[model samples]
Target chain A: MKFIIQRDRLVHSVQEVMKAVTSRTTIPILTGIKINTTTEGITLTGSDSDISIQSFIPAEEDGNEIVEVQTSGDIVLNARFFSEIVKKLPMDTVEIEVQTNFQTIIRSGKAEFNLNGLDPEEYPHLPIIEEANLFKLPTDLLKTLIRQTVFAVSTSETRPILTGVNLKVENDELTCIATDSHRLAMRTANIESKINGTYSVVIPGKSLNELSKILDDTNELIEIVITENQVLFKAKNLLFFSRLLEGNYPDTSRLIPTDSKTDVIVKTKELLQAIDRASLLAKENRNNVVKLLTHDGGVIEVSSNTPEVGKVVEEIVAEAIEGEELKISFSAKFVMDALKALEGTDIKISFTGAMRPFVICPLHDDRMLQLILPVRTY
Target chain B: MKFIIQRDRLVHSVQEVMKAVTSRTTIPILTGIKINTTTEGITLTGSDSDISIQSFIPAEEDGNEIVEVQTSGDIVLNARFFSEIVKKLPMDTVEIEVQTNFQTIIRSGKAEFNLNGLDPEEYPHLPIIEEANLFKLPTDLLKTLIRQTVFAVSTSETRPILTGVNLKVENDELTCIATDSHRLAMRTANIESKINGTYSVVIPGKSLNELSKILDDTNELIEIVITENQVLFKAKNLLFFSRLLEGNYPDTSRLIPTDSKTDVIVKTKELLQAIDRASLLAKENRNNVVKLLTHDGGVIEVSSNTPEVGKVVEEIVAEAIEGEELKISFSAKFVMDALKALEGTDIKISFTGAMRPFVICPLHDDRMLQLILPVRTY
Candidate 1:
């Protein structure tokens, strides 16, 4: 491949593709990024067996010449060193040329780098999915949906299926759910599509996280193509492919409570800060549990105690309280994560009892809810 | 102990003292911070065998009350947990009280934390250093002197004395020199003192690093007291104590060449960037060597070659070249570090041959100089 490309454009494309490149991959070729140059533009691809990402830079962008190609070819270079070199090159344009014996030369200003390249033909082929069941949504909305639920996915490998987020679409509404048995996060949004029947799939949480990081927070529409064993996300000049987890996701609707014995609406920031301070001492304990108690006059008490370290107690004034008074103990980290995900000024927390799971949602917003199981404390 | 202290003041003092506190200390009490409340102020101390740091928050500073003392006592609390709690406390004023059985209660706003405290008697006593031969220097100058030479200290423990910076005082001039046998960094500054004789000691690089971090960039005079085996630095409300390394430091004066076969003056920043880019590929090799060749014209070539990877060559414009043309290779990392430490718009580099050690100094300043040994390359 022989091409001269703008330094900034090459740096951005290399970074985007590197999201799928794993440093410790068992396959030697997977540690390298494949660069293919054609008459249209230059394409970079990176894969780690689970997911693959490809980024393209056209010859011209916005009436500005981005790349000048002299020949069409393909080669793979070590992603880590190549990315670092590209970032530190001291020139506006970088020239890359591929010679015989897989030798690649990169020149920028007075600095030139020659990196050993591997045969691109040995790299794994990307699986293609049909565009029949494609759905479109704003890139920002998809990023938000991933962020709101990805953290709740099970990090433990004991239950492999639970390590992925379940996506279900019905009647033009798409719902994303992630749970680790102790807590669950659910978010629903409307997507534009013409599917004739309901569609469901489970995507690995790690793939979603990497995708979200590479996706910009723009209003540009992203087309998502889904199949039985694979999924593809297409943006302006990026294509992301992820393998679907082969298993059935557990039904989590029953874990969320439909009625609440106690409900209180409080300013999110105040309650978050109070719980944060109360959890400082509890952090040294194994469970890191903090207790919340509702009292008369719209007062809430948050407390945690560790016999060897110390104990912390905090009293906060709630905006309003309804239903019966209650007390619940749960993981401080779980509650903090849920509160951080539910982006709003005010939040309403509902409790069924002291031992059952409770749900928290943004005030006046019914599209998203976070549920946490309480810990039994003597 | 009973006192109410401002949170910001407490946080700053705790951070300053934490530099001496190590989590993996064998002495249990050494891992805790000793908090002593007196009628005048509150004192916080942390020690880790090699060094001790104490910060005092007086009752008032600049006519603003920083501490309100209700009683006088002392207690030791776990440095790790206490620092975390103090950082996250949600109030401007924090109330601390010690009750029976070393139980400590810290109250701030509506939140309260009770932590288990150790008996103050178990904590080690601070060593007393006589202030007979005390010297004074600006805090900023001291910090700069430390930064200029500390990076050259040997990190390997094979020769323990090489891991320290040698400080020699003669004729009211304090000179600091550090070398790892391959390179040397020396910085000298004049100080006001009442001593009549010369004094010298080796201070651990780690201790100097920590001390410099806590010292702000102000012109405040710092009192430095030198003892036979210990050194004490006292600022307005802070006292830092460090033990001296017990060994003879090697003489580094012979390592810096007196004459040069080739001398070149170049912009510090431009040469630094060129070397940085040339080192990108060289970093993958074990030696990490970059070659510099001076041409008849005012041009210098910087390049590196790795057979398996590729090669990079760059020609840079030198401000002036007055000596014989020569070619030399050296560790890119060492050259970059020396360049980073030298502060000036231009630098003068003198080379005595292809193999002899060279010297680098600021264009017009003689306070600091860096010497580097060139690597022999085929």
Candidate 2:
């Protein structure tokens, strides 16, 4: 590819695409980033088998010439080294030229780099998805949805489907759910979509995390297109594609309790701090379990004990107490994750019994809920 | 031990002492921090055999009462867990009481912790160093001296003594030197020592790094006392002791060249950036060597080549050039480290020939010098 591009613009685009570059050299071609120059602009693509990211730099942006193309061609260069060089280049503009032998030369001010390029034809092509099943959502909302649920996904590979987050879209609501048996997190939001489609696609949690990092918090809308086996997210000048996990997601509707024997309202920050202190001792134990005891007059006690380490007990005043008094023991990590995902100041936690699973939701909202299985602490 | 201490004051002291606590529980006692309460105040100590750190929280400081002691006793508790709990406790004052069996109860507001503590007698004691061989220096100067040379010490355990930095104090000058055979760094500063005692000690680089982090940038004087097998540093209410390396440190005086045929002065920032860019390509090569060629009229060219990765060429204008033009190749990492340690904006580099070791020092001063050996790149 022969093109002259602005240093800042090229650096920004290269960084976004470089996230998908494969670190492992099992397939040597996968370690290189493919660059293509056309009449419209210059495109850079980086991909592994799981996900791919592409960024385009147009010839002109807002009356400022970003890229000037002399010929239409393509080449692949080492992604890691190329990105590092571009970031540290000491100039405002950079010139890139490819020779007939596929040798690429990048020059900026007094610095010049000559790289051995590979033919772009050797690189794998990105799968294209139809726009028929596309939806639009604000970037900030999408980021928030990913942050709330992605951490609850199973990290183990025993059940491959559980490693991905189940994304379901129907009617005018979009719901995202992630569970690892020990805990479950769910978030629901409204988006604009024309066609009525129910997508039960399980996207790998790791891939979703990478995509979230590339999405800025701007007010711009993102277009999401889902195919049978792949999903594509398109922003202003960036394209992100991730392969979907194959298999049926477990039915988690029954896992959440439908009734509660007792319910208590507590401040999120107060409960989080108490749990954090109790966890100091619980972390030494194998299960890392913390007990919550609710007494009369809005008083709740949090305690944890380890035979060899120590024992900790703390009390937090609940906002309101309802029904009979109760005591439950659960993983401190699960409770902490649920509390962090909650946006409201006050949270209502419902307990079925001491041994059964409990539900935690916002004080006034039922759209988002979290469930955690209690541990039997003797 | 029975004492009540301000939460903020106790937390600050505990953090400093916990630096010596061992992460590996091979020696169980070494992982616990010992707290001694007396009529004067409370003293916290943590040790891991190689290094020991003690922080004292007095009864009153600057017209504020920091501790209220009811009795005199001592106990040892798990350093990591105790520090974490104290930091997150929800109270301004913390009350600590020890039972006859060494069961420690720490209470803050509505939170209480019962820890299984060990007798302080079981913990190893720090060596008592006399003030006869003491020297004094500003905390800021001492910190700077440690940072300038400690990074060059050998990290490998093959030669135990090489992993330590050598310190030599004479009548009015103190010098610190560190080398891993491939490169060497030395820094010297003037200090106040009236006794005219000459001493040489090898302190572990890891301990020095931790000590440097705890030392603030202030004009307060730090006292250094050298015992037969240990070195003690006393600053403010903190006391740090480190075991000396047994074997003798190799002499590095001959490594620095006194005369040179070629010398060049360049802006520190410009040279640093050029070296960083050239290193990107050299990183793929075996030795990460970058070559510098000097031409007439203060023009210098930097380049690096990898057989498979490609080559990079960059130029930087030198502030001043003298003597004959020459070309030499050296590890980019060593050059970068040397440039970062320099205090002045402009650095002067001296070279004897293409194969001899070069010296990098600040333009106006010679208090610090870095020597790097060139790689024979054909």
Best by the DockQ measure: 2
- DockQ of all candidates, in order? 0.76, 0.86
Reference-based TM-score of each model = 0.97, 0.97
Residue-wise C-alpha lDDT for candidate 2, range B1-378, written one tens digit per residue: 699999999999999998888789688888899999998899999998888999999998888888999989999998988898899989999999998788899999999999989878889878878787788999999999988899989989998898899998876789999988878889999887664568888999998999998888997899998887899999999999999999788878877889999999999999999999999999967668999999887899999988788899998889988998899999999999989987989999999998999999999889899988899975
lDDT of 2 by residue, A220-320 (tens): 89988889999999999999999999999999999998888999999999999999899999996766889999988789999998978889998888999
CAPRI band for model 2: high
- lDDT score, candidate 2: 0.90
Encode model 1's per-residue lDDT on B1-378: one tens digit a residue.
Answer: 799999999999999999999999999999899999998999999999799999999998889999999999999999999999899888899999999999999999998899999999999998899988899999999999999999999999999999999999889999999999999999999997666688889999999999999998999999988899999999989999999999899877777788899999999998999898888878777769999999978999999988766777888889988788889999999999999999998999999899999899999988899999999995
- Give the i-RMS of model 1 in Å: 1.4
Residue pairs of candidate 2 with colliding backbone atoms: none
Off by over 4 Å in 2: none
